[model samples]
Target chain A: MATLGNSTNIFWHECPVGKLERQRLLKQKGCVVWITGLSGSGKSTLACSLNRELYTRGKLSYVLDGDNLRHGLNKDLGFKAEDRTENIRRVGEVAKLFADAGLICIASLISPYRKDRDACRAMLADENFIEVFMNMPLELCEARDSKGLYKLARAGKIKGFTGIDDPYEPPLNCEIEIQQKDGVCPTPGDMAGEVVSYLEGKGYLHYQ
Target chain B: MATLGNSTNIFWHECPVGKLERQRLLKQKGCVVWITGLSGSGKSTLACSLNRELYTRGKLSYVLDGDNLRHGLNKDLGFKAEDRTENIRRVGEVAKLFADAGLICIASLISPYRKDRDACRAMLADENFIEVFMNMPLELCEARDSKGLYKLARAGKIKGFTGIDDPYEPPLNCEIEIQQKDGVCPTPGDMAGEVVSYLEGKGYLHYQ
Candidate 1:
């Protein structure tokens, strides 16, 4: 009888699979559209709108929003800085997989640190990453606190709040920046249209 | 002039929106097909077959495979129990999002524990979870040993394996069971046809 611990067993593992070929047949390129911004800057809104537009236009897309992700995928992760890094890291990995399957993944998160966001960007193929910055001013975001998060932070009820006790390093070269200045947000539809246009111009969105 | 924060905010933070509508539009109900078995039990083979079938028949479908997933999303997680649990949890969440988008998600993983597997099933709508047990015996899986993982586990080289160093609890009730003893492994074309036929029979597959 032959024992299982042998070198010959390992050689049997070599097999070539055509993942990219299948992706091409799907008629869309895989890419990650990462959305970074402060709270209430419409990151989730933009992400959701982009998803709707893509679905309506017959493009395969998925959204990874912060709150929803925490309820499931990142449930074990806390709001601590280190945990936050791991959270983004896991999400970045998942988004990469979605891209690999020939689906455009729209990821929306606060993602405060320049280093962390930069690390995520480094993990992907160059053309596959498009960073969208929700560039609303701090004062405006603080005032539009629907979740009462900024208010809690203001009263010192929350610790390590980005844009308060913590910092949010803006993307140095983001693809899109939806800036909210004097009390107006770009309509979610308009924002979604912008993302679709970007993908279209890049030849990512097409009717099949 | 109104400042950014003080403007009226309108966003539904907790709503399971468009899921049913999406199901209606796709004419196919969305669900996650969780495939579990020892490595080399032909999990990936079966999953690829189902995917190809869905594709040719023009149904929206995708597969969240272990090798592809480990190479990307779950890359940071090791074979530790905690890591494995987290890996399943994350994939479950992502699969839920895909289901909500009205796409059939076929997830292939060892997913060794009944507890962890059940946890994944609990995350979705009742009928939206299908557990498929690839019940090829351990000896047969070892004989095939497509990845040589079984040999590695037996040699004390890989810790926390599913069948050797670790355990795999069979499903109490699964939607499908593919056996390799007396029963036969379906060819890619046959498997695809069967899956399409089943989906059509269940009224979960639509062509509109």
Candidate 2:
């Protein structure tokens, strides 16, 4: 609800260069691929794999992983519900900025709240925001527990852990959904391939 | 102070593709050009010009202008001292991420505090952070108040404005300084040329 300080005094300075211009220079359309799921849901792996795949194909992309962000950008934040919302909000803003600069911004975060993810999606154009839901069940993620987070949450050492105490509202209509079958996780390469194929099929890779 | 939430539970996910690899793909090194000065000192103009110049030369660059960011990324932030610090801090973090993505990130902000700028510099590698001080006097900037902000601040309509009530700390050992004389502002193209020359002279354009 906070408006621009003295809107009369602040005018938008139109840059000589724009998103379309940058896209032409990069030879690719800019977009935010929002990857959401529980911990150990292969979100980071898929995001990193997609980045590497894009790199091999000579495309510009970057992964804005949640853990990596906590180490720097969101270091001041905690795991409190408010902090989590702020965390996703900041990531959403950063992703929008990167996308505006004409780069594929892959955001790998356990964005538990549907409202939070929806808020992020609202920040970008419909075509620019791609929600890739890693729809692995909570039990499967807990079993993998790559970071021993599930154990900590189970032992009551960490409270409000997503999928344990907190809730993860899965996306109702995500652009891409990668679901686990029979407790089997998909390989990162295959998942990345699916995402890249989607982009290609949607004509996001071809410059107009 | 806020160590990455449960440092034991978090392991650094090193991407197979890294800064160097991205730089190689882009054919340009990543770096942050932190442009600091009083308001109306042509920071945005120089940043946009530099971005345009980089584009013409087939280099990827983006300008993170403060006013533009406030319209989106930092809209919640205000002109208070704490808010100002947070604004620069967030900008620094975003610039770092963009630089990591192998693009020249030009951050144009008032950034009146030395400690705040120093904090931003510390977030980046020594070679990757380039401090560019506009170095124009307050009187000249007031005379050229393109947005009439100086008049508002002088008339006491805007409180806590930099160069009116708050202090503007100049950089002690900036990488570049562009000064205005005889109430004349240098052409944005000329200023941008100086920045490109510095990058070229320092061998930032060549990959190691």
How far out, in Å, is residue A50 in model 1? 3.0
The candidate scoring highest on TM-score is 2
Worst 10 residues of 2 chain A by lDDT: A1-10
Tens-place lDDT digits, model 2, residues A60-169: 99999988888878878888888889989999999999999999999999999999999999999988899999999788888889888899899999888989999999
User: DockQ: which candidate is best?
Assistant: 2
Residues A22-91, candidate 1: write the lDDT tens digits.
Answer: 3555567778999999988888888878888877776667777766666667666776788889889888
Candidate 1 regions with alpha-carbon error over 4 angstroms: A1-27, A180-185, B1-17, B24-27, B181-188
Q: How many residue pairs clash (N, CA or C atoms closer than 3 angstroms) in each of the candidate models, in the order given? A: 3, 0
lDDT of 2 by residue, B1-208 (tens): 2256533345567898999998997888999999999998889889989989988888889889887788877777787889889989999999999999999999999999999999999999888999999998888889888888899899998888889999999999999999865656689998999999999988777677
Model 2 spans > 4 angstroms off: A5-9, A181-183, B5-9, B181-184
> Per model, how much of the real contact set is kept?
0.12, 0.46
Across all candidates, the chain A TM-score values are: 0.87, 0.95
Model 1 C-alpha lDDT per residue in residues B1-208, reported as the tens digit of each score = 1112211211234433366656665567888888888887777777877877776665667788755556556666666788778778878888887787677888888888999989989999767898888888888889887677777778887776778878889888988777753566656566556556767777778635
